[model samples]
Target: MPTISMFYGILVSMYALDIDKHHLPHIHVRYNEFKTVIAIPDGEVLEGRLPIRQSKLIQAWVELHRDELMADWFLAASGQTPFKIDPLR
Candidate 1:
């Protein structure tokens, strides 16, 4: 997994050639011990859990960078390194 962005103690990443689970454009988020897979298009939690505050932050970040995320997803699915996205400020 390669980290694509980080903000407010949240780490966002994408795995290259990842397709078996969460077969959609998504991101893996981690904040402290909590982690979750979130769908990129809708900011829905596809797996795992996070604090409500962290979850909201993730959704807002996703919404702010949906296009970049989708592009990264395509690159990652094809086993290419994804471009780093700007962190939420």
Candidate 2:
């Protein structure tokens, strides 16, 4: 997993050629011991959990970077390393 962004201790990544899980454009999030798979472009929680505050921040960041995220997803799903995205400030 390659982290594309990190903010407030949250690490966000997308696996290259990942398709078995989620089966859609998504992101993997890690914060402390919590983890989550969040759907892209829509900000849906596909699986797992994160802290409430962190979850809200993730949603907002997703919304702000939806376009870039989708672009990165395309590259990632095709087995290319995704570009780093700006973290929520």
Candidate 3:
């Protein structure tokens, strides 16, 4: 997994050549002991869980960067390194 952004203790990452398991564009997020997978297109919780405040932040950030996230997903699915996206601010 490659971390593309971080903010407010949240680390956001995407895995290369990872499209079969979750079967959709998504991101892996970590905050201390909390971890979750969030869908890139709609910020849905694909797996695991996060604190409510952190979840809300992730959703807002996802909405702000959906296009870039999708692009990164395609690149990662092809086994290419994804470009880093700006952290939520």
Q: What C-alpha lDDT values do all the predictions have?
A: 0.93, 0.95, 0.94
Q: Judging by lDDT, tell me the better candidate of 1 and 3.
A: 3
Measured against the true structure, the TM-scores of the candidates, in listed sequence, are 0.97, 0.97, 0.97
| Candidate 3 global Cα RMSD | 0.6
Question: By lDDT, highest first, what's the ranking?
Answer: 2, 3, 1
Return the TM-score for candidate 2, rounded to 2 decimals. 0.97
lDDT, candidate 3, 2-87, per-residue tens: 99999999999999998889998999999999999998877889999999999999999999999999999999999999999999
What C-alpha lDDT does candidate 3 achieve relative to the native structure? 0.94
* Clash list (residue pairs), candidate 1: none
Give the alpha carbon lDDT tens digit for every residue of 1-89 in model 2.
99999999999999999988689899999999999999996899999999999999999999999999999999998999999999999
> Candidate 1: where is the Cα deviation over 4 Å?
none
Error of model 2, residue 1, in angstroms:
0.8
RMSD versus native structure for model 1: 0.6
Clashes per model (N, Cα, C within 3 A): 0, 0, 0
